[model samples]
Target: MVGYALALALPNGKFDIAHAARTPGDPVRRRPRGNALRKPAGILVVREADMDELGWYPNVETPEAR
Candidate 1:
């Protein structure tokens, strides 16, 4: 699983990975070069009980008409 692989890649095997699924890197292919998912920008993670709440909503501004 992606989560398990990520855990092994971290420096101390401890992390608060929020958005670790957006990455498209193939771990099997990039593992040789120490490919690990890094924290993404503008992302948040909330943990509740037995399940985690994950969301990836992006905010893009629309240009006003000239």
Candidate 2:
């Protein structure tokens, strides 16, 4: 989900997944613009197969993994 958003946000569509994962932005609130909240709009469609190329690892083990 985040990868897709980053892909759209980046002009070249090249971003560091590790950096994004480590220093993530606020998920609940949108970015602020002056005194107004930035409009939350944009649609990105990512195919399941393309996720691997985007560095998405569904099976990667984490501390919470059991």
Candidate 3:
């Protein structure tokens, strides 16, 4: 199964991923509609192995091979 790591930027200059959830396909479309009332989140598609934890990856150039 496919999964994602989702996190939102907080006003205190930190990220919040306490609400980690699973969604299919487009990450943007998967976000809750009420998210507009909160900080926008950052999403990255990940494999099942990577789903064990919640984390953030910023400005990553993700190619199958780096």
Candidate 4:
């Protein structure tokens, strides 16, 4: 199974998940509809194991040092 994270950027300079799935293939089933903040500003795909190290916040922007 693969892990996926879908983040949408908010007008307030923050990010939120539009949808998430761990299915064997195609994590996202349907395209998200656009909203006032605009839909699907960012999409991130991460291995299940790496999620612990990478963290969940897509807007955080982790440093290379880690």
lDDT of each: 0.36, 0.31, 0.38, 0.36
Candidate 2 vs candidate 4: which has greater lDDT?
A: 4
Give the per-residue lDDT of model 1 (tens digit) for 1-66. Answer: 245444454552123343333334442443422322333332333222322353336744448422
lDDT of 2 by residue, 1-66 (tens): 344333334333232221222223442222221112122343222222333355435767668656
Poorly placed runs, candidate 1 (over 4 Å): 1-6, 10-37, 40-42, 50-66
- Candidate 4 regions exceeding 4 Å error are 1-15, 33-66
Model 4's TM-score against the true structure: 0.19
Query: Please, what is the TM-score per model?
Result: 0.19, 0.16, 0.22, 0.19
- Supply every candidate's count of residue pairs whose N, Cα or C atoms clash at under 3 angstroms: 0, 0, 0, 0
Kindly list the per-residue Cα lDDT of model 4 for residues 8-38, writing each as its tens digit. Answer: 3335223343333333344434333212223
Cα-based lDDT at residue 12, candidate 2: 32
Local lDDT at 58 for model 2: 72
- Give a tens-digit lDDT track for model 3, residues 1-66: 122333433332233332324444444563453243234474333222335464457646659538
Candidate 1 accuracy as TM-score: 0.19
Q: What is the lDDT of residue 35 in candidate 1?
A: 25
